[model samples]
Target: MGKHSKPSGQSGRTEPASGVRVRPLPVRSAVRLGRPSDIWHKSALSAVVAMAVPALTLFALGRLDLIFYTAAGSLCALYGHGLPYAARARMLLWVVLGMASSVGIALTTASLTTSAELLVVCASLIAAVHKTVFDAARLGPPGNIILTFITASAFFVPQHLGQVPLHVALTLGTGVLAWLVCMAPALLRPQGPERIVVARALDAAAGLLRTEPRADGVRPAGVSDAWHATSAAVHAAWRTLYLVPTPTPAKATARAGLERLLMRAESVLGSMGQEAEEADRLRAWARGLRGGGPLPGVMLSAEQDVEVLGVTGEVSDVRRPAPCHPRGVRPVLARLAPGSPLLPIGARVAAGCVLAGWVSMALGVGHPYWAVVTAASIYQANTTLTWQRALQRTLGSLLGLLLYTALLPLIHVGHLAMIALALACMLGAEAWISRNYWLGSVCITPLALLLAGFGSQLPARVLIADRWIDTVVGAVVGLACCVAVTNRRAADRIEVALERVAAAEAAASRLLAAGPVSGAEGAREVGWARDRLAGCLAELREAVEVASGEWWQRALPDERIDHAQQQGHRALALLVRQVSMPAAVV
Candidate 1:
């Protein structure tokens, strides 16, 4: 039952008002929506669009020479789309390092021997280790995994050691070209738009809370959906922040605003659980209150506090509404101001780089594919999840190799159909694997099999042996590095976030006790408290996830800790609303 359990919320209903004029509503659904980003599209285009060029280059080199490294280079387009330029620059450097290492290892292994079985086993072990360790490093998705698969079998290619530098140089060059394609023209500015987007999201959550169904009814479908949707968006914003080259003023504000919005959203979610029966019926009626227009007003102050977020579109000058609070309570809702405690950008990037570099040294020193896996393994908003990802990578790599061996003969090595199938699988894997790593691994194994065939004529048995070997080696070395490098400040971050939540709650209490409040300033303060709490919660979630996976994590009072923090958050939300009514009506 818990598996199907849904969080409670205000029911969608509307109370009949006497003497009110009823008008026929429009047939269209009314809901606020933000413009979408094209990061994925851009990244994909940057890589695959250049497919023709890679083939041509290989042709020019006088060998249908399997554009193996070209595939590795294709991933470079996604490297720095969301980061500050400096961070992106740094990441690019690391990507190159990782790629070089992967290709180097595969080439070395391939050239070192002609035994098909030995090569297969070796490649599989290295592939496993590559997957495991890179995940532990926290490098993240569209990461080095692709590169690893490509290079792990580069060993089977007939190229001599003398050709290693040339091969690596070409791959890196292609990746750089992919990177340039995305950076050439920046169309939509994210920072300013993001600020408005987050603000709107916060506003929507508050409005939903204010009109939630009463205690005796089912939650409004849309409001409940929004809760999950917003949570995901908040997470995405953090990831986007990680990708950006620099923190623009607008983005910084947006980031801060997002943190506050999350806090408010959580408070609203809690309130929905406590609404009375009257509220529930009202929620149901109101759920159908359709109008093709902007959101309902929840007045707050901070609109003119700073200059307009200069953006391309016609900027709206609407003032923010004050945050709504429940009657008869005085929680510190206003204290949840947005702050810098959300994303541990520096720590994540630094640790990720180190993990990547180490994996590169180990895998890169011999075969570059292992280094690629290391890059994929190390990325996560939470370091602990990074470790889990590493585990998944190892498991998937071993399985992938096995699957590849089984299907090898059916595909007919060096055939156009096999290559096409491989590319198709790669595309599908990237698209669907987002659901989970293992599912993606299933497809990736087959793709790798085809790619290996592109450069050599090894039979099914030999291919199977070498693939498994690379996986094991890569997984082992990667995890070891995780133990060596610890995210020392993870615990402290959780502690500090809890403290901030407490502080925000306290502040909201002080403001509400004073009496009725109104105007944008009041709303801003309330919104701020709500957002900060959300951020604290996010941090807490990350910490818990990390602690669970971290092999070296010591004992932590997780149960007691999370319980007390939630209690504080609930109290803050209720008290802020209770105390604001008197001053708010004025």
Candidate 2:
């Protein structure tokens, strides 16, 4: 095949060299624009599809009020659901719960008191804490500021206590419609193609680690692209997994095994820092020779042919090197087994139970419609992400409210064109403004203004005032909850990650110790080990950062963990170089 060189628009921004014309987006601009191709397209597709059901339902019933509920509820399904375990499911549940709870809280407060400003502030604060703590607060990109509209506006929403149940039921019915529309059609059956892609990723990462860092070979540009593709594939796979029921024992087992193998490969490669300059060049040359195609020959052992590149006509016999093993490595090598333990059913059950509780409580409260929003925000694979999201929600909402208050009066409420303009702004909010929390808030302000317009047309300034007050309340409350509900201790999480690293390093050591073997099994073994080690190293770094942050609250033995992690990093780097090119003879 022919070679094509192009930049992969990946995350981590890098400066363009002097001659390079490609200009990267500034972090701030990127965050503000919020890559329409990434978050927006995914979310808007869900939202637009979901809107169909409600629009049709309202068309049949001739009740525009119901459409509002439908529109609100359906928005729930437009979030990031296809992420790894706990993240999608948990966040969705939180959004639903948060929406429901905020509705009730806002309504109750509104009904009991005449202080509209106070109620808005109180509601915003409560929503913020609820979002922050439980991870269920799903107010969307601009955060809980939308809740200001839901709550403070409840004062004038024209409803009796008796109508609460029916209105809530209507809203939830729409929400369910939204949920079905979001998930039912697009999902893959059995396993997604992404899974196959993930498997391939495991193979690619392994290849990089096993090769000695050499300067002789032309670096395969594809290597960077391949690694990125793998990461995206893994992320996609995990997201899809969370959306569905937990995998069966067989599937889960297979996945676990693959995960372990990949981990081992990562660890081994990580042990090696940058190799000698000549070796690096040689490796890069080899990569260039192999470019635009599958691996040349069965698998090249690290030692065989120092010549990196070869003519296209002669693909076979590229270079076959002997495998490398570490000293006294048998015990560690044995651990690189294929097979994963089945995921616990109890975890699934717990997740479901938590989801259900939040849903029920949200619906039971006065402003139950807000439940959808709450349920969506709270679920996360790690509590750290959940906390960050919570803070974002609180801060974003406050910002949105302030913006709304200032801008509302500038727009005319009576003009239908203005309403249309507001809707357009909302779509823009949904389309952009996802990169950073505060930036998204700008879009959210107009969206809320539009949503509120659905019910009544008060003076822009008055509506703005109410919005700011409600946002304040929800943000405060959501943040408070974040502090209250904490799980998955950071220290413990770090320790577990270290343990995994240790296990991977040990296995790679053993593999290196074993003399080189020819044929398929030997190749497979080496490939698997390489993959596992690389993953382990990456995860270790992630775990360290997470643990460090949480250690502040829980007080972990930071010094010990830090020292161990640093040692692991050094050892892993060395190991990578040593194992890059396998030797033929023991």
Candidate 3:
């Protein structure tokens, strides 16, 4: 057969002459905005309460000079939103310590260096390190950028060597308080975060089901997009449940129930006829979980019950043992070595920050660190995201400035009153942030201004003018760096990830084909392969997303990657089925 012609035995279309299976070009949506998330209220409430503790304490003590450090520490409360309690506890502890360490470093460095140039360099390096470490660990949103912002901003605060210990103490103290405030919700609702994960999965599954062809046989516009999204959500839910660290009997039971619910959702995906009813049931269960009420039991049909039973049996029998991975300094140090994907991001961030700082200083901005922070905040995993962020930051800052101007007269009433207004803005910013970056910025801009004026009163006009100028400067400098410093390896990384997925899927496929061995050793191998395949798929998806966002890059192997993923998932499903039926495997 000719290269472009289908082979005689093949049932599908032939590959192209060049051996590329090109897909239709992706259409760019005019509306590239995100919807409001349900967790916004929780996140906003957490920030307000966490910030309030430090602000109220400092206000009562009349130590406004130390308020910034305390507030900086309080920001630590914003992390680990969807993590299980055990995981969240560990994460929050690290965050608080990390926040304190950043403050300590800032204070010590500021004391040693009076030169603005040297301080800017130190801050840039710190920002780079923060970016690298946070990315490596996958700490999620309100991520290392905020930590860098707080630390870099601290460097600009006038500090005496004698005051270092006190400032550090304030940061540590408030950090501890913030940790406590974040953990407080666990007392009332121990499984809230985990339930949220399940709820999200259910909602996503419902969305996927809704995209199925109607009874009249009409197809929807974005059914393929919806399927991909739902797949991601289901996988996320499984991963979340897997990592839950359920040490107690009650927690373990809850975890198992969540697993069953997820399995049912998956089965619903496979059998499209009952999509709406199943979707509604899943949503109802999700709502019950969120409301802290009795879970509405989903009555499965006989076949579904059998499927659920088999899945549960498999889960109990061959759940993979968690692997021992390097922790702490080891993982962080590993990322700094040559060829780490995170290294490029770190380099870009450092360059952007240093250039922004220098430019801000040249412009004689009163707070150059603000410009530096703005620049640091704009660097996402790829240039496209960076472009979006720069736009969001600028637009948000502008609106925020307007809000600041309107609130300035009211804020000028008293220091305590300003603190109250700042708190309100903090609440608003957090509430709106998940909806859209710009909306969040509207509150963040005014909140930041209020925070800066904490210890001393500044002329509102000058403050506003400087912020506006610095914002534009930072946005321009940041976007320039993104264009100049590209992650050329992003596409290559996706290729490598695809290879890993292929390997993993092959291993699992071999196990499924080989019939179950009698010993634990075989089960362990099968489990490991399954876990590795899942991880690789997740990594591949992330890499593809990042690569697709790069401008002026080579055309990505989108069809190839998609084909591999689909095959891998099918192999995984087969492996899962074999696990369910040990006799068939044997």
Q: Give me the candidate number with maximum TM-score.
A: 3
Q: What would the per-residue lDDT of candidate 2 be over residues 1-586, giving only the tens digit for each residue? A: 0011111231222223432122232233222333343335556666666666665556567665544555556666665433432344455565555555656555555556654334434543453344343222222353443433454345435555666666666556666665565455335333322233334444545455444344665455554444333343333333233233333655444343333322332332333333344234333433432232222222223321212112222222222222443222242233222220011111222232233223333433333223223333432333333345445555666666666655555555533444444545556566655556555656666665656565655666665555554343333343334334443343455666677777767776686677653454454455445445545655555545443333113444446555555555454454444434533212
* TM per prediction: 0.55, 0.50, 0.87
What does the lDDT come to for candidate 3?
Answer: 0.74
Model 1, C-alpha of 285: deviation from truth (Å): 19
- Residue ranges of candidate 3 with Cα displaced over 4 Å: 1-33, 213-219, 272-274, 296-337, 512-530, 573-586
* Model 2 per-residue lDDT at 50: 66
Ranking by TM-score: 3, 1, 2
lDDT of 1 by residue, 1-586 (tens): 0111111221112224432211221111111122334244444454455444675566567565557777667656545544544455556666666776777777776667765445544554555445444444444556544554565547556667777778888778777776556555444333432333344444444455554665677665565445534444444443433333323554444344333333333334445344344234323322322211222222112321211121221222222222442211122122222332222322333334334434444443433344334433434433334444555566666767766656656676435556556656666555545555755666776776666566666566665654555455444554455455555455555566567666666766666666544444554565455445555555455555444434343444556565645565465445434322211100
Q: Superposing all C-alpha atoms, what RMSD in Å does each candidate have to the true structure?
A: 14.3, 14.0, 6.6
- Candidate 1 accuracy as lDDT: 0.48
lDDT, candidate 3, 136-195, per-residue tens: 887787889778878998898888889999888988888888778788888998878878
Number of the predicted model whose lDDT against the real structure is largest: 3
Q: What is candidate 2's local distance difference test score?
A: 0.44
